[model samples]
Target: MNPDATTTGADAIDEAIASGNDFDGSPIPQAKLGLYHQVMGLEAGRQRSGVSNTMRSRIVRIGAKHIPQAELNQMLVDADFAPLKDKEIAFYYSGK
Candidate 1:
């Protein structure tokens, strides 16, 4: 994938979410968008002590939805990120 296409796919999704429209240009329901913004606003204000930790958090938050657990783990390892912790695995992969 082109690295500069637009940060990451998650970033694009976030932009769409913030715009209150889907990629197809349909309006997102106000209630749903408001709830999304409420939760994400809390996350945005969270304090982080390190860049790597923030990056890992984002990868885990977004990657879990699209990538398989084993694949995501390997991707993280390949990128020099710490492998998923047990709690992360349980939370991100359990339902899938």
Candidate 2:
């Protein structure tokens, strides 16, 4: 069996979110969908520095929601990306 054939727990949840659906299979709110599409469209058109920079951006954007600052910082360092900047720390961790 291919391990990727079945997704469970958080992986399934992430897939659902990426599909713009809820656990019950209902569509996400139109307003949120609209905003998401708008942002993603902008992101698609934006010029990227490179794959590593894009990876770092994604890590900062999504990891901040799930990982503690210290752990996320360590992960970035281990990945050979620069540590979080002051603005990122202020914006992402300031609410805690």
Candidate 3:
């Protein structure tokens, strides 16, 4: 598939872009693309512990830098909110 190439077919390009990219808020930097998995793990840790130790971990950034802008601008919602362990289920919502 040639991303930069233009085709004259309805199926040529997915209209998903019209729906708006949910992950646009965050974009994996070229240098950090390889660390996407590790960054995801860090997000999980933050969600669980409610405390971010990114500065110490050095594995991922704590704020926007930690998240790819494409992801952050889209479906991804960044937050430091903590879940109560006592609660069986917790939900967090983010929107523009």
- Overall lDDT per candidate, in order of appearance: 0.84, 0.84, 0.36
- RMSD to true structure for each model, in Å: 5.6, 5.1, 15.1
Clashing residue pairs in candidate 2 are none
Question: After best superposition, candidate 2 residue 68: deviation in angstroms?
Answer: 1.0
Model 3 off-target regions past 4 Å? 1-31, 48-96
lDDT of 2 by residue, 1-96 (tens): 223434555477557657777766678888987897789889889987999888899899999999999999999999899999999999999999
Off by over 4 Å in 1: 1-46
**lDDT per residue, candidate 3, 54-85, as tens digits?**
33222222324444434533422234423212
Per-candidate TM-scores read: 0.58, 0.60, 0.18
Which predicted model would earn the best TM-score? 2
- The Cα error of candidate 1 at residue 49, in Å, is 1.5
TM-score: model 2 vs. ground truth: 0.60
